[model samples]
Target: MALALPRFAVFQSTVRQKNYLRYIHEDGEQHGFPQFSGEEIVSPYSKFEIERAKSTTAEGNDNGFVHIRCCYNNKYWVANSISSDSFIIAGADEPNEDQSQWSCTLFEPIPVDGEVGSSTTTTTKTTVHVRFRHVKLGHYLRSLVTRDNYHACVSTSYDRRYSR
Candidate 1:
């Protein structure tokens, strides 16, 4: 049996005005969503207000997952698309279960993608190797901001020659 997810009895919103989720329009005209995609979208603490995420799908109805909308507007919060992170409020002309719909799930952010496969058979824990120093070990990985022809090992000792 599948494990059940958390649910909120009431979806509430505290806002003075309508919450508009702004996203930088990348390659297309500034307008309605889904057909056009934006570079990035963010629901900042100041601009947008989302105190709680509601699991509409868990209600056993056709809610199909969505952010609890602003109490005043009664619009559904939607992620623009999976491919693009741009976000917009669901319009009444469109269906509630459209691509704008989103579901909440428990997640642990990992360093890199593709390190973990999607299959349920096997699981893997991986970390991405970037130009950063390890705390315990004095060694450095990846070359970053260095003029040396070869990679130099950085020890615990501070050196003006090689900036840490």
Candidate 2:
């Protein structure tokens, strides 16, 4: 049996109630995830189109939603409308060491009377209510199944599992 991964919760209060984009850095800098300043250069193969498509699909909804674009090795991992506060990774890439980049965008909640017309207008109060959760189940797997020091051997696992 596989071990269960740990869960992380991102609350609206923790992230601040603001509708703005930012990044989380290794040095505990919430606004420094990319380790860069100014406009970011994205790859042509990046899932910019896919991200826009997904965002379009989430057009009007009352629930809070957030989209996060994670870039690494010229690859883009787009997570849309992550309503949950926690994330469980059976096995995932590392944080800072992997040279991965992440950008978070908060979307305003759609109004209750919003319509789906050409000029539909929704009174969605712009606020930051997206959260992130990083849980690693690899540790339990290593201790229970492989019986090897997976945490110490795999750099990615080590960073994701140990780093805060």
Candidate 3:
């Protein structure tokens, strides 16, 4: 016999706009806009965090550098760089049981093309394909909000290091 699960009611809140400038610009240095004062506005929900990472080959080496961005409440942390033969899978696919539903999967590292750089200033580019499967409803919802937060942090960190 299979056990039955209870259904929980879902509640929706009114959407409001709040000052996220502080989270966006946690660092003291300002670039695009002036510092924002703590202000509150009506919002349905708070924003979620998300992060992105990249890998590249070093000059004269067959292997490349793999970077995994760290998560932060505020967008201002450096991505921890690592040399590995790994990659992350990202995407969505239809669920097995429900055609109307979708799933997402995080996979292990896959092989990628890498090239060596000649000088320190040199850079190489490569394309990566990611796929998702077996995504859960709860995980998906959480990911939806978290992804944005992660992205903001990664963007800020990348800008600080690469941008002139």
Please tell me which predicted candidate would have the highest lDDT against the true structure. Answer: 1
Per-residue lDDT of model 2, residues 1-164, tens digit only: 11111122121212223311213322432222221121323322121111221222222333333222343222222222122321211111322211122222322222223322232336633332222221111111111112332211111123334223
Q: After superposition, how far is residue 148 of candidate 2 from its true place, in Å?
A: 29
For all predictions, the C-alpha RMSD in Å is 19.0, 15.4, 19.6
Q: Candidate 2 at 99: error in angstroms? A: 25
Using Cα atoms with residue i matched to residue i, what is each candidate's TM-score against the true structure? Answer: 0.21, 0.21, 0.15
Q: Tell how far residue 70 is off in model 3, in angstroms.
A: 2.7
Superposed model 1: Cα runs more than 4 Å off: 1-67, 90-95, 98-164
Report RMSD for candidate 2. 15.4
Please give the range of 10 consecutive residues that has the lowest summed lDDT in model 2: 136-145
lDDT of 3 by residue, 68-100 (tens): 111222222121221121111111121122213
| Candidate 1: residue pairs that collide | none
How many backbone clashes are present in model 1? 0
Error of 3 at 90 (Å): 20
Ranking of all predicted structures according to lDDT, beginning with the best and ending with the worst: 1, 2, 3
